[model samples]
Target: MPRENLPEGFEFVASLPDPDGRVNMTDEIEDFYGKLDIDPVDPANISVGIYQWADPGLAYDAKITIIRLSDEEKADNAISNFKSQYDEMVARGLPIFSNATVNGHPSLQIKDVRGDNSIRYLFLWRAGSLVTLVEGNQDRNQSLELAEAAPL
Candidate 1:
C-alpha cells in the first residue's frame, strides 16, 4: 500500500489483523473464494489495507489487497481466475470491463450499482509474483488512480 500516494482527502484505516505479518490464504481458502465467487489459487502470503475518504459527503472506502504467490506463474493464474469470474458476470449482462490496463498492466474493472444509486468499482491486476486487488465505493477513474498509485 502507498499511503503517500492515496488520493487527496483519503485517510488511513486499520489494516486487517495479520499478527504474523504474513497470512496464508490456504487456511481459509473456502471462505476467501466464496466471498469473491472465484476458484481458489494458492498464494504464498497476503496483506490488506483499508482506507476511507475524509469527506463525509463522499460515500467511498477502499480496500487494497496484495497477494504474493510463490512465482510469477502462480500470480498469473490467480489473475486469470479472477478474470474468468468477471467474464461470467459479464455474460450475465453486468457492467464489467475485462480488458482494461492500470499502469500498463492488464486489469479487470467491475462496476457494481447499488440500490441507493451509488457505484462501487473493483480493479484487479498482477505484477510479477504479486496480484493486487483495488476495490472501493468510488468511480472508475478514482479506482484506476488508486491502482496506478499502488506500490505493487
Candidate 2:
C-alpha cells in the first residue's frame, strides 16, 4: 500500500518551532512508537509522518499526522481504543467528540477548550489499515477539512 503524505501547503516541522523557524526533520517512527502505551501491532512495519504548515495568509497553524497499521483489524482496534480513552475525557468535559465522516470513513471530531480564549480541534479516522489525524491550533473546520483529504 502507498504511504500517505502531507497535503498541499504543509511541510514537516521537526519540533514545535521556536518563534516559527524551520527545523530539520528526522525519522519519526521509533519515537512515535515509543510514546504509545499500547502495542497495536509490530511497530517495525508501521508508516507514519507528521507535517505542519503555518499560514499567515490563512492565520492558522495546521498539523496533520498519518499512521498506517499493518492490517484493517489493527487499525480498527486502534481507533476503538482511542475512542474509549477519549470518551472518558469527554465525560469530564475536557474534550468532546462529534460524529463526522472523512472520505467515507467514520471519524471523531474532537474539540477541547484550552482556556477562556484558546480552543483546539482534532479530527481522527480509520480507513482500512490507515489512521489519520488532523489538528489545528485554532481552526476547527480546517481540521475536518484536512481529515477529508486523507487518502483512505
Candidate 3:
C-alpha cells in the first residue's frame, strides 16, 4: 500500500537509499527489526523506531532511536548499551522504541528533565527508568511528524 494510505499512527519514513541503494519496506523492517546491524561510515544507516497507541498515558512514552558512530566498535557498544538500557526500562511495561533505524539514518537520543511531570508529553526512549537518552527529547511529536512528513 502507498504511504498516504497508512493510518495516523503509522509513519512513512524512508528515502531512495544511498551507496547501499534503496530499501524495500518488508525486507527493511524484517531485516533489522529483531536483529539490527550497525554501519560505521554511514552511521545514518542505523536507526530505531517506535509506535504507540492513542492513549493519554502512551503519549508520554513514544519515541525513536538513531545511532551514528565512526566505527562498528562504537555502534556495537551503543547497541549493547541500548539493549541493556531498553530492556531494563521496558521490563516495567513502559512504552518505548527499543530497535529501529530512521530511514537508514543515524541519530542520537536526547532527554529533558524538570521538577514536574504532570500535563507533560515525554516520549521517554529511556525515561526516568534506566536508559538515559543521549540525543532525543521530550517533544514526542517530532518522531511521528518527521515520519509523516516523509515523501512516498
Best by TM-score: 1
Model 1 lDDT per residue over 55-147, tens place: 654665687888776677766666665566556667888766756788888777767656686778888777887778887655677677777
lDDT per residue for candidate 2 within 1-152, as digits (tens), equals 21245445556553322334343222333323332343444434343334455645544445555566777766666666656645667777764778887777777887755556567777777777776666655565555656665556
Tell me which residue pairs clash in candidate 2: none
TM-scores, all candidates, are: 0.70, 0.58, 0.28
Model 3, CA-based lDDT: 0.37
Backbone clash total for model 2 is 0
Q: In lDDT terms, how accurate is model 1?
A: 0.66
Candidate 3 lDDT tens digits, 1-152: 12444435543343323347454423422322334443322434434444443554544333333334445554454445444545644677655443433344332332233346432232222212122122222444554344333321
Total backbone clashes of candidate 1, pairs 3 or more residues apart or in separate chains: 0
TM-score of model 1 vs. true structure = 0.70
The candidates, ranked best first by lDDT, are 1, 2, 3
| Candidate 1: 10-residue stretch with minimal lDDT | 28-37
